[model samples]
Target chain A: MAEQDLTSSSILIAQAQTDTGNSEAQQPGNAAGTNDAVEEQVVQEANDAAQGITVVVEGSEVVAADPAVELHAETQGAYTEQEKSVFPPFDSSTFGPQLFWLALTFGVLYLLMSKIALPRIGEILEVRRDRIEGDLAEAERLRQKTDQAIEAFEAELAEARAKSHGIADETRAKIKSEMDAKRRDVEADLAKQVATAEARILKTKTDALANVDQIAAETAVAVVGKLAGKVSIKDARVAVSDVVKG
Target chain B: MAGTDPISQFKVKTLFSFGTIGADENGANGVDLVFTNSALFMVLTVGLIATYLILSTRGRGLVPSRLQLVSEMSYEFIANMVRSSAGTEGMKFFPLVFSLFSFILIANMWGMFPYFFAVTSQIIITAALALLVMAVVIIYGVWKNGFGFLKLFVPSGIPLPILFIVVPIEVLSFLSRPLSLSLRLFGNILAGHIVLKVFAGFIVSLSALGALGMFGSILPFVMAVALTGLEFLVSALQAFVFAILTCIYLNDAIHPGH
Candidate 1:
């Protein structure tokens, strides 16, 4: 659609050029022939009508600028008389300067590109490439270092776990041995107390038995002496012996 | 005080006249060396290109600034175009392609400004540049491939009887390359500018009628505005087309078979 628009517009321009060319060729003949007389007559009539209007306005106390009107008309006339060629670029007179300048400017630009701008840009691109490569190499080295550090950390963690297990085992054995020694001492003290308690009981019983025998012997002798003075110690002693044997 | 004629805008007026120089009796100063408006714009184009490419990269930072990025992008754009069209061996002609691209691109852009003359609109200038490209192609093709370059005018796989008719047609088409290349750029620019001027003329002429005419002038004014925008695109597109064509032609130089 856009391309069609361009082609149609270009066709319009070509038509306009041809029209201008024909008009230019006819311009001299029109001026020299009767057409100029008709144009002058029309201009005269228009001038008269403008003047009549101005005079009427002046009678109403309004002033018109006559000089400005004349100037405008003169300029319009000059514009109409200007060259009618549509394509100025085809003029041969201007070609030399246009070509000369084109060559000069284009040559200078070519030199600037090949000599300076392009090479400088190439250098910058090269520097960027090298910088990026260096950064990548450094990153790889740091990554390797990180990997080694992680491996070492893991190894130390494993050793620490083994040492903790050994320490715990040692602590449990020491606690058990100390508790066994305390128990043995307590048992020995208890056994000694029990032996002393038995010895006290045996002593008390022996004392009481000896007291009973003496009392009994004394009572028997007193009774025999009081009742039958003449009854002998032999009889009392035999009585006491028989009672003890029973 | 003549009224402005839009067509006069394209005229190349003499800025300084050196009044000819050399051995011709009819020549005023013997040479027709006159600095012109076209010359001024051409210089301006070159200056702008230099500023964009050279000064922009003066810092050459690892992280590019906007200007530097633009310069680099332009460089790579042309470089890659050449590489793709002409192959890696075409890189040797990188400077030529680069120069042509930047010059035309800047010239086209600078012409977009109001009251500025568009150099590429001239058939003479574009024709000269196109002829230069053709010259390079012929010289390089003959030098590198010798008589083998003539094979470009003779297609392969054609029967012997048909070769006679096909060969002349091929040569004629080959010779028309520069003409087409130059005319395409020139016509696009010339027609666009002319359309813009006509629309602008409508606005001026319409607005002179009265209050109603002033209001009616808005239509042409809008059209002129729209055309200005379109011209901007046309300028850039034409420059790109011209550059790519140059690369394709140069490719024929480097490898001249079908």
Candidate 2:
């Protein structure tokens, strides 16, 4: 679709060029008049050709003005009239132009593609690939760092737990030894107090026994004075001492 | 002229007649270097290709737009085709293969449109392109491989007696490659366009007949439409065939034996 439009436009441009050439050639006298007439005829022919109508070349002036335009019109007319087998594309006459343009265009395109377009595309592809690979490498590196961090955290946690357990054991052992020493001191103080109390009690008991012997001797002397009891004071003391001994 | 005369469409009309350039007298039977519709369309093909490649890649974004995606896909498609057919070494010729593919594809597609000249339909153009490919193959083949390139015709493992019979056939076949390659593309596109024109002519002629002709014209019109669809496929397929064949020939140039 685009090709046809471009071709027609190119044909128009070619027609305009021929028209200008004719105008330039006839520029001396009656130039404006011939130009106006030639332009009108060319426009009509172009329109007719576009409409697929056979354009009738009316005036000799238009034909005289531009022989090339007339030739183009006649050629187009003859083209439709002649059998397609005799077409110039098949004819050797047009192959030169066709091949010439083909080479020219193909050469330009090859240079453009190889030199400019393909390399740019290749660079884009290469850049995208490199970016992706770099991102993946970075992600892998970060993942490794995270793994190392986790490993370190676990190691530190284990160390802290072991340290806390040792501290607890040491505190428990120190408290247990201090309590045992305190209980031993209290027991020794109680034993010493009991020994001193026993000694004092023994002395009190002996003194009380001597006082009883004296009281018995005095009572025996009073009785002897009063009767026969006085002579027996020493005997009474000895009897009390014997009874105490027994 | 009959409306169904399909060959008429192939006629080349001179658009601008510049009598020969640089030469005073008419040389070579007055073969003036007049620009014709063929040149115009060829130029258009180049323009379109440039537009497609350049405009599509203008952004050069990492994440492609639709047009960029299409351009990239076409690039990768031809790239892979060259790689697979010709191997990694063939990638060096990717530009040639890609240009040929794009030009032919766009030309064939352009021909499908009404009033457009299919450049590939012309024998001269296809022949020129095919000859260029053959030239590259021969030049590069000989330059790169020296005499080893001749081994492409002579297989290794053939018995001595059978070698005499096989070598000439191999040479003949190798020589015919360019002809076959050019003709294959030209013939397919030419025949396809002719068929389409004939069918379209049917509708015109039938409808001109009368009421009954008008009803009959529908059949030809429908057939033309269907054929247009098929021709679209043929256009792309022929371009692919041409390009892949070029790659294969280049591969022979690179690795000649097997």
Candidate 3:
């Protein structure tokens, strides 16, 4: 954009220069002729379709300042004004004493900035940008790795919880079954002991009744022998029989 | 500090004479084609700018060293100037504008040292610079719009009746380019140096009084010190303004009459 501006302005100055000069004053027309020549070249390339270079040489004065005289007069007057601004105006003509050195300074400066200063700056910015981008990428990669590790850890925790719960349930069932079996064995042993005791009591009662019957028969025989004298043996035998039946 | 009389002490005999071609009867005189104090220092400034910039930029690393950092800062300063004033679309002119800014700034600042002659204090130097800028402005303006650039002299919005009066003023203003541009630079630089010189003169003349006068010399010395710092800022500002104005003038060329 800027280059175009410079080019266009130079062209404007060239046009103004041409307009200011008569045909005879075109000898030192360095910038104007070049500009016109460039326009002509553009036209010649386009051939018939192109607009020929129309030198707006004879336009109204309101349009363009004659570059040749206008630039010279303005610069000259500016130089005088500048001198008056600081020192006594001195000689009005001393305005351009250092013109060559000024040009030299500008030329030298332009080269340094363009060639040296600008590139260094560009390089620094490029590096900084690249560094930031690289750091970001590295951080992202680390974050992704950490996320994967965390996911694995969470999965392992859930599996461990399930395994622990399963073990607890199995242990609870095993303890309950063992306690029930032990209770059943204890109840059966207690019932058998009660049955044996009942059988022993019934046997003792029957033996006592048999022994009493035998003893009564013996006593009745002895009494009859004694009462045979009194003819009582039949009575004694009947009494014994009665006792055994009771 | 080069002796107390920096400007006067560096004076050299006039080498030769020249003329302004056709603009004035005498082109340019005082010193012809040889190296004088101003020329030597101007060359020194260029050399310093070149050597330092080259050394700073030789390796071109992603991370800059101290030297490289200075170089980069200078670059960013000019780049931003072009970008902000001229717009992003005009950033391509960064190299040119940035170079001009740095060169002028460095030259102006270096000239501020005691006993150092400010090159910008010379009118011819400033005029040449102004001419260069004017040349750029006019050439670009005509190139973009051809005859339409003539409209720049006659602005819009004022009543038609008032144009007759406004036209001459506008034309004179437009024609005052080299003067305004050059004088702005020359006047500022010259004024600063003259002020510094006058104060130094006071300090010197006052010291002859006595112990009381010696004590009083503090004020002038302080003022000179303060002025020196101010001069530094002014030099940088002037250079920046010069470059910015050039960009503005170029803008006129791109969009003529605006």
Candidate 4:
């Protein structure tokens, strides 16, 4: 219901606005018959409008000038004369007060500005300047610190890399030497075992040769006994041994 | 007839009277220390300057607020103007310069309102201000430079025969400083306001004639608006000119030479 009332009120205001607009529009059309009449009417209304503003300024002046109620006959003529003087700026009656107030207000302004606003504003500007310079100095210091930190970090990293390389090289050298020594020792042991096996084979061959000569002599003796009975076995062995030697 | 009269606006209507002192020779009643519309606007002008400047610097933020920015801008603007014109030694006069600048600037702006009184429009007011400026200049110059401040009138480089022509001119000009300063301001403000009123009155008068009059009033209305803009510029510019002149005059006090 409130929304409806608001909308209805707005519509009424809009209609009233149009109505005034139409009335203004209708004036020239209604006065179209007589040009001189229209001109006179315009002049008359313009004069009234001009008077309206004058009265407003005058009314405010009257209200402001005095709350004292006295419209005496003597003051009325003086008022007209005062109003007729036209150029109030040149009027000497106002000079004394204007000068007085100018001094007072201008004095107040100078005091307020000089003693209060100027110094405080100056201080604010000074404080801001100091703060900016300090902040910039602080930022420079922090940047330098960051640069130093980066340098130290890089230095540490390079040192750690160098140390790891040295350790790796030392370990590699030590392991290579140990492996060389073990290879030489294993080769020497294998050579010693091969020499002993070769010596034992040669001895076995010589011993077998001696046993072959005796067996030949015994075979030869057995052959002779079968041929010439048991006589001259020693002599048959001697002959077989001499033939085998040849 | 008096209402439409542009000159009527400058009338010093007393707002609050402290009673009459005595009747003058002209049979006019003399009022005792009555506060007029002129005084009201003057007080209002001072109040505005104080309120704005004080509030602007109140926060004192590292990152300045918009108000603070404007406040500081005005501060630095006057400060730089003083420094440039008067040199570093002239910084002592910063408060005086700032006050005059803000006071005039604000007063002129307040008068831009249709019904508001323009304090500077009065000859006596401007003359008083000009006298105040000259007072500061004379006092400070004499105090600082002693008898040597007379060098301001006599050029050091000019030949003796030419000095005859130049010295009197310089003296006359020096004597006329207050007059020129006061008249310059008063005339500018007084003329600008009168013109603005006349143009505005044209609009009001024309627009009262109905539709055809409304269309015709447009020309004056536009002209008035344009004049208003120019007046605003003049207001600010005159303030700057006044302050700078103050600085230049103060510079002579600091270093009284060509």
Q: TM-score (0 to 1) of chain B, per candidate? A: 0.95, 0.95, 0.84, 0.93
Ranking by DockQ: 4, 2, 1, 3
Looking at model 3, how many pairs of residues clash?
A: 16
Instruction: Go through the candidates in order and give each one's C-alpha lDDT.
Output: 0.79, 0.81, 0.67, 0.80
lDDT: worst 10-residue window of model 1 chain A: A73-82
Chain B only: TM-score of model 4 = 0.93
Chain A only: give the TM-score of model 1: 0.36
Q: Which tens-of-lDDT digit does each residue in A42-127 have in candidate 2?
A: 77766666444222222333334444433443333223332233443476657777887888888898888998888888887788
Could you report the DockQ of all the candidates, in the order they appear?
Answer: 0.26, 0.28, 0.17, 0.31
lDDT of 1 by residue, B1-258 (tens): 124466776776667765455634533223466778899999999999987789999999999999998988888898899999999999989999888888888888888887888998889999999999999999999999999999888888999889999999999988999999999999998888878888888888888898998999999999999999999899988889988999999898898888
lDDT of 4 at B2: 51
The number of clashing residue pairs in each candidate reads 7, 2, 16, 0
Predicted structure with the largest DockQ when compared to the true one: 4
> In model 1, which runs have C-alpha deviations exceeding 4 angstroms?
A1-86, A148-246, B1-4, B23-29, B157-165
Position A191, candidate 3: lDDT: 74
CAPRI verdict (incorrect, acceptable, medium, high) for model 2: acceptable
DockQ of 3: 0.17
lDDT of 2: 0.81
Model 3 TM-score is: 0.57
C-alpha lDDT (0 to 100) for residue A113 of candidate 3: 68
Put down candidate 4 lDDT per residue, B72-98, tens digits, no spaces: 999999999999999999999898888
Top-lDDT candidate index: 2
On the 0 to 100 scale, the lDDT of residue A81 in model 1 is 26
Q: What share of the true interface contacts does each candidate keep?
A: 0.67, 0.61, 0.43, 0.72
Q: Model 4 over residues A1-246: C-alpha lDDT tens digits?
A: 334444554555555555545555777566544645555565565455556545655665665443222222122212333244336888666677778788898888888888898889889999999999999999999999999999999999999999999999999999998988888888888888777777777777777776676666677777767776774646766787789777
